[model samples]
Target: MERLVDYLAPRGPLDWVLKTALFIAAINGLNLTVEFAMNGALSMSLLAHVQTTSMVAFPFTLFALSIIRHQHRLQGQLKHLATTDMLTGLPNRRELLRRLGEERRSFGAFILLDIDHFKRINDRHGHAVGDTCLVRCAAHLSGSVGPGDVVARYGGEEFAVLARTRDPAALEALTTRLCEPFTCTVAVEGLTVPMTLSAGVVRADADLGYAELLRDADAALYHAKDTGRNRAVFAPGRPAA
Candidate 1:
């Protein structure tokens, strides 16, 4: 039943029209089969009947297609809302984790970072400016990564990056690029907000389990924060390469 409904609900106008035509042909064929069984003969009147039935069904088919298209669009919007962070337009944690599970064996490294003094910014400048700063910073971080890499909003004031390459030097360079944008003060709503990031990096080459690797990266992040913020730290358990 669900499959039939899905097949009838085509996603585009051309598909809807094609499917409707095929359905009408099937119905006309069934009618001809029954008429032949009863009278043991085919007639030209069948053609007129088929044409009239098709014309009668056309407007109703078009109406149903419109409703189906609208439902498809609404489903897409709801899926986007579920997987995306509304504030920064980045993938939310659920989406990130889902992607990570798919790419765990293939991904080169995982990076986790967060604003150094985000709470202070929110307290001093109010939530509005802090939100503006977050939006700007998310854009900056997104621009620093390669096309294949994934950057997502991990949680409040925190971001995660799934690096695509296994090269240690490239990973280091990416970390620097991620932080470079915040070296200067960001102006949001006539307020100057100084921002910096402390990141933890973990290479997946060591054959560590996904959960363990995340923990190592988190530990390294705290290590950076403990020593001093604004620097990126590679997990001690994971080698540079």
Candidate 2:
């Protein structure tokens, strides 16, 4: 089957060539074994026969590798499309949730941020300008987070940051950094647009599931939106059972 061939195919260029050579050698050995069994003697013609057959098979081997490589590249692109936001090129909500579930047992902080008056921007400047703002916002958040942390486009005008750390000071530092004013402005159609973010921060307990983590963070985000537009609000920690 095509799937089986793809699964067995080597991923790297050198590996594929090496495997192809080995495969041809294997087939040649089998043919020689069968020939010697019946002919009762090996002839010098065997060497010439192998050289001729290998030369004949080389083109087919290259063609097959080309197909396999194309399929692999396509599969990789599909995976990226599934997990990434097309406009922002950041991880999407689905990918963030997947990571949250995986890190449920680890103590961390979950922060949800929304662009303040994002609809106003869309209405006033059109969706194209709004999209440009979103792209710039994503770039800023992506650059702000630590290497181990994840920043994702949670949905339209909203983003999520998952920081894997137990220290409260570290969490506070991150929230403070996010709450600080964005240093850059989006330039679209010769117009400068300023952006501000409102965020909800929640401590992730080891025993807490991702569902609860999301819920707590959402509630905090609501608090931030309700209290003021450009601020971060911390959700109260879950009481010990």
Candidate 3:
């Protein structure tokens, strides 16, 4: 019974229509049976009344179903807007923080990646090209990161990746993979230009707060940018080699 209610609850108008139909049918059938038992004949007027009630119920049922479907669609769209980056289609900062809180206990690594000289690109090529670079960088990060990794846009050209693996080697390798030059063909003056990225990786431990992890990664990223662009830096406390 509970399962039936659960199923019917979601159906909204369709369920109402079905219940109304069944109710009208039951009442009409019962009335006809009583009439035949009492007067030895069934009445056509009783059947007509049931049909009229069914006709009246149809429009209300359809309206209810339409409302439910519209609500379901709206909820889906709202969820997407809340969680997804509008520019790059990656998970946004809010979703990233939510994942960090949820997976901090289980994950061992947090990486913060930023596009090196992103402002230069925007200044030289325009915001349209800058947006293209961001989108391409997001794709590269998504592809380079391992399965079950949480990748998110941390605002502007910066991105965050949370990985669960305990192996520092694996994390470093992933960082190296992301730093490789990305070639995006931007339509600038009827010509195309390429892009590159730099990344910083930090290992998460019980001693570190999520903010501290981000800071560490940001520090490494700053180092990477300061020394040279298109490089990966691992946070201190990992081996020098």
Candidates' C-alpha lDDT: 0.82, 0.80, 0.75
| TM-score, one value per model | 0.85, 0.82, 0.72
Model 2, 74-153: lDDT tens per residue?
77788899999999999999998888887655538889999999899999988888998898888888777776888999
Local accuracy of candidate 1 as per-residue lDDT tens digits, 117-187:
89988898788888888897888899999879989999999999999988889989998888663632445
* TM-score: model 1 vs. ground truth: 0.85
Q: In model 3, which runs have C-alpha deviations exceeding 4 angstroms?
A: 1-62, 237-241
Model 2 residue 160 CA deviation (Å) reads: 0.6
Model 3 — which ten-residue stretch has the worst lDDT? 1-10
Per-residue error for 153 in candidate 3, Å, reads 1.3
TM-score-best of 1 and 3:
1
Quality of model 1 by C-alpha lDDT: 0.82
Q: Give the lowest summed-lDDT range of ten residues in model 2.
A: 232-241
RMSD of 1: 3.1
Model 2 residue 51 distance off true place after TM-score fit, in angstroms: 3.3
